[model samples]
Target: MNTAHKYMESTQMPSIVAKSLPKTWMTWAVFFFFCASVFGLAMRYFFIGDFPVLEYKNLLHAHSHIALLGWGYLLVTGILVFTFIQNPIRLNIYRKIFLLTVIANLGMMVTFPVQGYGLFSIAFSTFHLLLSYAFTYHFFKDLKNIKSNTGKTLIMLSLVWMVVSTIGLWAIAPIGSILGRLHPLYYLSVQWFLHFQLNGWFVYALLGLLLSFMEKKGYSVQISTPILIALHLSLFLTFALSVAWSNPSNYLLATNAIGVILQAFAYWIILKSAIKYLNHQTNLSKNWINHLLWIGLISLLAKAAIQAALIIPDVANIAFTIRNYVIGFIHLVMLGAITFGLGALALNQNWLVKNLISKIGWITLAFAFVSSEIILLTQGTLLWAKMGFIPQYHLLIFLASALFPLGLIFLLIAQWQASFQKHQLPKFIHKQKNQFKSKNTETMKSTVLMSLGAAMLLMVSCGGGSSENQGSYTPPSAQKEKVADPKGIGEIKNVDLGDGIDEALAQKGKAILDMKCTACYQYDGKRVVGPGFEGVTNRRRAEWIMNMITNVDVMLDEDPVAQKLFEECLTRMPNQNISLDESRQILEYFRKNDFERTGGSDAAMN
Candidate 1:
């Protein structure tokens, strides 16, 4: 009996941590990601041909809401809880919070597509917001117990940004009601929420998680004072880029340029530190999770480079004007950086099931992400350069998109398989436990030295002592900045009309209106999807009309009269991808329509 008791004491069998992350929550989050991918695949198919039952706009609402709320919010919160909170009580609270969020997500998933921000969808969205507030409160309450200063600082800052982002969402209702949905203020509010949510909250949280992992891996990870100042300060300043598409003030553009430059500089410091740490890890292996993490890090670096490119006015304009570029960039961050990073961490922790199927799933997902990004960017570039559309673009992208759902399905099945694996202990251990007396002295003596040897091996394997590669790189001083000139980038500020409308231009413009403009507007001042164009040449300046057509999004955001029209129409105008010349031609078509109405004079001269 003594021997058995001593043996058990000497063995010191490891038990599950009291605050082990809830695998079930993570699994459900992945399932939501899979669902979001399916919706995305369906959207891609819509580009190839119309799906009668699927409302493209409503489906878009569903896809974005589910991807952001169902997958992003849930996964990020789970990761933060796993990394920071240790008390079982806090863990329980997080579990309950997770379930509530799940309910909100499911509600949005069902309601968004069915009613498109109707009462139910709004209710669910509001519920989710309230729940997030609760989560923020609880998380901060337990934050003091965290030992890692760098991680704690980042986590806290991320939560602050998360809360600040909601201020934008809350402003939306009032802004929309007062200034209309198409008002610059309304658009600014919406972008404010998104900018902070993606770049501020998500970015910081992931970095914090990374720092925590590095600390755990026995690496001395520290954010230098200069880099830290640049990183957090840049988050606030970089929001100017979100409103840059609206042709914001020169000061705003200058600030954004500075922010992006600072952001790039900060990332350089971080990248160097990460490389040094990685180099020092002699025990690192070619594990799939490690490979995934490397890919994620590469994507993060690429994201920094892309943001830095926005310092060019032309690049900034292209980013907003081209829908393909916008979508591609969002996916690059969401899938390439955020998803890959979190997925790698989950895999490292064995939270994601490890199996042949899961390996194939990761490979498929990686390939699909890369292939789809290439297609989207290539098409966007072609369009930007006034080159014609890519041949079979929609079809090729849809095929690539299909693999996302397939990969997720394989991963989901692997997780289910892990749940059913035999959980019995090794036969030898079981037999010894069964046979040994309660206090077996002999058994204890036999394993005592082995236990000590194992402890020593673990300490050596984990690599003790201060990291030798720490603080090797000095951060570069802030550079004297030159802001990019935003004039005539994507906005048309003036137009010089000739003495009379060109008859041939009117004829060409008539064809374009028939094909594109007619879907939304009528020449007879009858509103369809948008306000009519019957007397638009008289009501607005020729420059205004042309600018509105060529720069619909920016016009809707910045123009007061356009805001009123949007308020009355209760719908924002879509970008028709019309060029400056096409817009000038369309202006002539409006002139011709008004000439007939006025019986002789062209109101375009007004």
Candidate 2:
């Protein structure tokens, strides 16, 4: 089919159906994306300089919440309604649910930055979760009325994963409150939610939506049964990769490796299946929509390759330890793949304007994502290698991030123009349509080049600063003072131990030690990654032990005792960021353990 006929076949809706297609919802989804990008830019700015008024962690919470729910979830639901729900009543119900979701999202936007995960923010989040449940129910009910098998099973499974992912979120509060945020279970809960949402729900939904669109354009989607099973099974198994970060057993790592292999297999088979359909669409080869889809596929492949590399324990450890790697991977999936895929699907369906304006916007956005991801991964690798800073890395990242909002602004304007110019065109433009269109395209091409060139120059100029000039450097005196204490050259000044152990505190401390400390230290009189803790209570002062727990970074940096231990062990103890109270709790636990060995004589007290 020719391009125009293909578009007609894909997007030719009856007048009433077209009007009912929830264009406003799509616009809102794009607006949310723009807002999320602005928030992201604000976050990047903080790395250049401090803004104490806006807490960085709180902004992060808001950014992730809005970007995921406000933009990602909303866009998926809007497209699903457009594709599947033909009945007017069902469509109206979806509209209402969509509006409620928006309200919940707005509430989160207002509350999260102010109070983090306090009562109001949690309430808003809970409300959004309930709204999702409602959406899932209605979506399944409507799915039964549709007879098209193309992408149907995938869509259903995607929704099921969406609901299942919430189980992780619900587990977070209890784990965090009872065992503290540093607990492995708490981190595991958060990772569970993230893994399922990103790898399961979003991945499946986008793939299914793309297949559905293909079928609408008269292409048969012939996904084999094995490929489909592999896809679903891979999603469930790959969640082990998320659990691998907590330094689980070798068995779990092996399981994760298997999952990664299965995922790669599934992706390859699916890609192979889709190629036959894609190869026949010659007219689409040069289209921007096709280009975006290709970018998404390439990103997916890159993500899979990265996952494959993580099967190596050293690489997995580095990935877990480095914040940059984690952030880069998330963006790789969210921005580089899912967002681009969504944009292509939207453009294909004519939900987005197919014109020069959108083309420039998308190209700019693509450039920004690519540039920023490269910077992130490069810096992460440098850090992993202990090669230090990247020379004005934050500034470079900020400059690249600035382009995200700019591109979204162009897209927003394009959408506005589409809405405004619907069913209306000037007579002169109609008479000279080709000429006008070609001239605009040429102008836009020049504009895109200039914009990209300027961005590149800014990044290059900023990145030329010395790495020593950035936040990575710390002065000796300031570093010492950060963890210095008059009592023992560490943070803890005093520890008043009772004759007996604090049973409750000891229990909590034992939990913390199991999760955070035992990875390196052993309770038996045998050496491990760090020294054994069997007789530590008798060997070290209570204040000293507490200080080491709370101030390992500065202790290793400045204290002779810590340096001697480090030299003996030939390993630097990692700073677990244990709090003072937690350190005291750990001291109590040590006393209890030592008492068991010393026959309850409290020999350390002497």
Against the true structure, what is every candidate's RMSD? 15.8, 15.3
Model 1, 1-606: lDDT tens per residue? 999988665553211222123466677788889989988887776655646664555567789888988888887898888767666656767766776787677767765665554555677789999999999999988886667567678879989999999999899877756655655666678788888888888878877777777788877678878888999888888888766656445676678889989998987787677667766763347677777777777888888888899888767666666767878888887888888887787787777777899999999999999999999888777766656457887799999999999999998888767744544656765444434423332533444444445434433443321122111211111012323222212466666767777898987787667544443465775444466678877767677777777777755555555555664454456555678888888888888888887654445444
The residue pairs that clash in candidate 2, if any, are none
Candidate 2 all-Cα RMSD? 15.3
Best candidate (score: TM-score) = 1
- Model 1 gets an lDDT of 0.71
Model 1 Cα shift for residue 465 (angstroms): 62
Give candidate 1's error at residue 259 in angstroms: 0.7
Evaluate model 2: give its lDDT.
Answer: 0.72
Off by over 4 Å in 2: 1-21, 148-150, 176-182, 283-285, 422-606
Per-residue lDDT, model 2, residue 455, is 35
Error of 1 at 173 (Å): 1.1
